[model samples]
Target: MRSLEIHGVDDLRVVERAQPEPGPGEVQIAVEWGGICGSDLAYWRHGVSGTATMRHPFVLGHEVSGRVSALGPGVDGFAVGLPVTVHPARTSGPLPERLAGRDNLHPDLTYLGSAARDPHTDGGFAERITVRAEQVVPLPDGLDTRRAVLAEPLGVAIHAVHRAGDVTGAHVLVSGCGPVGLLTILAVRAAGAARVSAVDLSPLARERALALGADVALDAAEQLGQDVTVAFEASGAPASLEAILRVVARAAVVVQAGNLPPAPVSVALGPIVSKEIDYRGTYRFVSEIEEAVELLARSELAEGVISHELDLADAGAAFTTAATDPHSSKVVLRLE
Candidate 1:
């Protein structure tokens, strides 16, 4: 088997290794596609948190989908040749947030590909990955593997929507048009928001957001004349956060979904304090995976969103493209 490893900032290595065997209650999957997530790029470039946890040589990739090549002992009801998506959340241990049904908030949790978990070695970015059977969600008969790969990110979008509370009949602003932002727009529209405004620096992203059902797509620099009742700050840019504070109506709910790293970004606290606005953070939701799968199966958002596909051997290029190419919405690595 072959897998990509991150030794340090901007260092991605593709190497050969022995295939992994599934433990009891696990399944070995032949990865078909792996989506390049923003966090993956961050880990690739800066390592993790000022270079401590992400000591050299970690596998990085989380958004993934594939087919079951084999199943381990104690695994039942699922079989070989079944298409599936891997749930990156490993919620087996105790966490106050997870026990309260917010597994996404599990403090000590590790995703498939990370400094702590190293799923790139264990990720679908490789030819094969062995995951707990509980992490595999069977794809429907009609869903293609490429689209099924989206179940992970779509869950993120759905979870963000859930945080923004009662979008129906309200004007909503999504302050980013990346994959997550675009999907958030779709979910917002699906949730019956009266109108949606998407903001991004990329014209291509703005266009895609509109095509995905946003009423308006604005440049990040521009301000919405009217106050939005709800806002999703998917941009991660501090400016976008400020814009949301400025444009969202009093008592509005603003959900921070993007990863703004390197340092804590500053924000204007007055709007939140004076208006009694709800400022919340959302992580990938564990419970919404099934719903995300169902929505993707029902909606057409997954049809044309994938803009690029690269072979696993060329995954380094995929990472670069994901980070620098504003035009590319979703880039997937074909492990096989």
Candidate 2:
């Protein structure tokens, strides 16, 4: 089997590795498609994402879709060749009593493709890889592996919206129209937001934002009036965060879904205090992949986000386009 691994900053390689078989309570998947995320680009370009620095070579993907090729002992109800996507996360240990249903906030957690822990958790970019059966999610009707590659990121978008509380009939602004921000537009639109608007420094992102059902797409540097009732900061840009605070109406809810740098950056603070904005921070999804899968199966919202599909052998070109091409969003590698 072959996998895409990152050795260090600007060092992404496609190398062959041994094929993995399913273990007890696990399943083996023949990977079909995988999406390159902003974090993946971060790890490649800067050797870091948040505080997780790339200290060792590891497979670099989590937004993946594939078909079950083998099922290990004790795994039932799934047949060979069943299409699936993975949840990409597992509790590092038993959740504490206080965090029972809120497993996303567990004190200890491991996410695929992350280097937060030493002996970093390997991801699902290989041609065939084995994982716990519970991590596999069957594809819903009307969705296939290519489009299903978006399941994970869309789940993040949905969870971010979930953190925003009630958006029904409210005017919402999504700052930074990257793949996640575009998907956030879809999530908010589906959640009954009356009018969705987006802001981004990239013209490509703004175009994607409008294509994903946002009512208007504005340049990030433009002056924004305080009419939005809700706002989501998905750009991960510190400057955008400062601007978002100045634009949203007083008492509006703000959800920060983008991962900011670990180092401190200057941000204006007066509006947050004077306006009493409910600035909430959201991490990864807590089982919202199920809903994201359902949404993908029913609508074509995700299809527009996938702008390129390159073969796994072309991982270099894939990562390059994903990192440097502002016109491209959700660059997927065809693993099969």
TM-score of each: 0.93, 0.97
Question: lDDT tens string, model 1, 201-249?
Answer: 7888888989988898888634686568888999788888887888778
lDDT of 2 by residue, 202-225 (tens): 887888888899888888634667
Give lDDT per model, in order.
0.82, 0.90
**Number of clashes in model 2?**
0
Q: TM-score: which candidate is best?
A: 2
Model 2: lowest-lDDT 10 consecutive positions: 220-229
Which regions in candidate 1 have their CA more than 4 angstroms from the true location? 49-52, 97-99, 117-121, 220-222
Q: Model 2, which residues run further than 4 Å from truth? A: 221-223
Count of residue pairs whose backbone atoms collide, per candidate: 4, 0
Total backbone clashes of model 1? 4
